[model samples]
Target: MTRALSAFLVLFGLIAPALAAPQNKDGDSAEAIDLLTQASKAVRRETYRGIIVYLRQGDVDTLKVVHRYYDHEEQERLISMSGQVREVIRKGDKVTSILPDHELVLVSEHPPKSMLGGMSHFSPKRLKANYQVVDLGTARTAGRDCRVIAIRPRDKFRYGYKMLIDSKTQLPLKLNLLHHGKRLEQMMFTDIAFPDHIPDSEFVPSYDVHGFRIVRHQAVHVSESASDKREEQWHATNLPPGFKLAEDGVRQLTSDASVRQMLFTDGVATVSAFIAPAGLRAPLKGATRMGAVHAYGDIVDDTQITVVGEVPAITARRIAQNLVQEKNTAKKAPAAND
Candidate 1:
């Protein structure tokens, strides 16, 4: 029975490795989640200053930002190197978009939905549903130990991404848009630091110009209705991995006089489609690719459909081409009175 005992031991050894793998995976996942949670909280709590660069197809500009936060209130000052110095101070959803050129501050209620806000959307639970997040070892960035996580899309309706988060603070040090396993776009922190004390005066605007124009814009609200729900009657039979119907509405565009608006999101990225009745001008044909943004215009019957998104070119084209209108009535339907 010695041979039998040896065979049993071999089987046990093989099973042990398999059993241990799941526990290891669980541990890694928990650590990643913890990092993400802490980073989200840190962004809202910490105050500092640094230089940030926005890179896209046609435009490249570096800007300096100084932010101060206290009592759940934040004041931010932004200076553009290429253009005039502009300052924006935001308290909650209300923001003042300052323009030094006109010496005016335009008030708006949106958060500018910037790269910082985009990073804020990286919630561990919401992201886990659409992406398979795994730590791809570790590396040093900006003098910090960064744990790299590859967010692989589960479907073709969306693209994939990779993010590097600081091991100690959990803040994202780098973000990359992946295409076919390669980076199509990337945002990396050239230099970063967390300071304990930020001067309050730095948060205030620098210039004072008399007789400046102050333009205040109102916030647009989205409502749920049959017309809004059936705005384009659009359904994408094929989409890149991870995309879903994020929003839809009816609105008029300058190019087209008709009212139509549709929004789609793949959690991380979003695309807005606007359709309307064609103007008196002839139908236009062509496509334009602008950095991360792609715009496509086509005529569906007499309706002009335009699709814009920060996704790839092909994705924008496919979505614009698939625009359709659904009829409201069936053949010989009974009247409500009957």
Candidate 2:
């Protein structure tokens, strides 16, 4: 799991905590649930277009997004307006990302709904069990009256979330990612409008004068034995509250033989951990900040593991230290105490 959340924040351009306000009182409010439920529904049923800016440490990116929601069909197109020329188009379970100079396109098959799309996750009750949702009063965004809902992390491993949802339609107007009292990063619809129609041609791919090349590649493979087997049996004893294993596997980079990865999420935030053997060719030990996302690496137990996510340095450090590779046995297994 290469800092799962950090890479995702860069790739998807959604998710983050920005600008902090004081914590809200804890409660199970019919009003809060009703407000959040409405916002989730609105994101699914409405068609909108807007610009989203992703800010991390020193990097800032603006992406123009066009979205359409009808029936069971949801389509989105994202074009990078700064930095490198990158584009991503998604339809339901399929996503294709195109890189200009690299002349490569990567495709992923996903569940119909993902956290980035503002879709529901697991059961609302499961999330409420670990997070305390509270009403943080109101704010004005893009001329819309918005109600703020704060999700306070009940434990240390995970950060907190505050959202400004449209009061009229219950749609998310802005989202803030918070760690310990400070706003790490944020994403909001600086300007948004519910459009009546979006032409199908808008979703088509764009090509330049030199044309392009396609590289069809399969998913990265990890050997079940030998040197690569270490990652397959790795486990963690300490994790932030509300976070659970979401996805895991190996993804081959263009330059590597294979890279093993593990993904965890708390419905909204995702963190990826990547493991490779330590050697002259392994990744370095250091931390890099991009807007609200943090990428950090260290050599642990002779294995080079890099933990990156939209989380605080302390959270990432604790997660890195808690990784334990237990020995296997044929008998009943005993659970490790935290």
Candidate 3:
């Protein structure tokens, strides 16, 4: 029932006309898609340092970001300059997060395919299936001229995006996540500097970690023997349209317990389902929404199933309730290709 979704439903009827011929619609679509395509690339390939103002649910924080690409690879470092001396470094599939305040370090390796999801190049054709690309004219952000663009979602299951892309560098100076035509989250660059060289030491953690506790998230490797059909537990039968299972695996959270995880995405929104022993997680207790995160839980048979995503609470609840114990294994979709 969001305004964006309502607008999208009406927009669908005009899609054919929009793409028809020499018209402003066609030009707008192409321009919006082109800008996003280039911005995604610039975010990963270009080396830059900036101060980003992040706001969500009325709270704001100023964070510093540094990204560099070399030898056909990309690396990033995030530093929280206000509250605590915390930093996160990403090098390919492995990410290291350090908390100087708590003397802890978290290391986790994501599915190599989804590791660079944010930086992946976008496909206009594929994107058009779920969103309406519109040009919102031009504006100024971070002291630079920007091409304002809005990506309105076609369904309530996903959120819309508004971006102010730098005209010169093709980078997003301000990005906002919207719902009901309201900004739910915003990330805007207040100051930026593109430097010639950002040393490797800037990415390294400088805090004293002599006695820090380390929590390593063991990687889940789906081996040939483990892929046998009978070993899988549950499958989702009522998944929302356009959503595909991107990855699924089993990981041992403790010496006595192991959990099954399934990841799904509909090009924009990502959802995760975690199944563990019945008592490990609280029973299905409706939906819990905090800011942009929506979570729901349920007890399926003897397993506790929790579904969480950035989408609406209804989406998370529907996904959680669709868990079935049938033996049919879920076929995962291939990684998105740009």
Q: What does candidate 1's lDDT look like per residue over 1-338, in tens digits?
A: 11111111121222112222221332335455455555545555566667655554445556666655677675666666555566666666677667877778788674444212233333333344555556687988767789876656655545676767778766566666676786665655567777887877776667674578888764433434435655446544355444555555543333434355676655555677776677645565558875556788887666777888766776777777655566522322321210
- The 0-to-1 C-alpha lDDT of every candidate, in the order given, reads 0.56, 0.63, 0.68
What is the C-alpha lDDT profile of model 2 across 59-88, one tens digit per residue? 667788777875678787888878888888
The number of the candidate with the highest TM-score is 3
TM-score, candidate 1, is 0.69
TM-score of each: 0.69, 0.74, 0.83
Clashing pairs in 3: 284-297
On the 0 to 100 scale, the lDDT of residue 272 in model 1 is 74
lDDT per residue (tens digit) for residues 160-251 in model 3: 87878889888677878898798897778899888988998888876877899999887765434335656455677667755667667778
Model 3 C-alpha lDDT versus the unseen true structure? 0.68
Question: What lDDT score is found at residue 287 in candidate 3?
Answer: 81
Which structure is stronger by lDDT: 1 or 2? 2
Question: Highest lDDT, which number?
Answer: 3
> Scored by Cα lDDT, where does model 1 land?
0.56
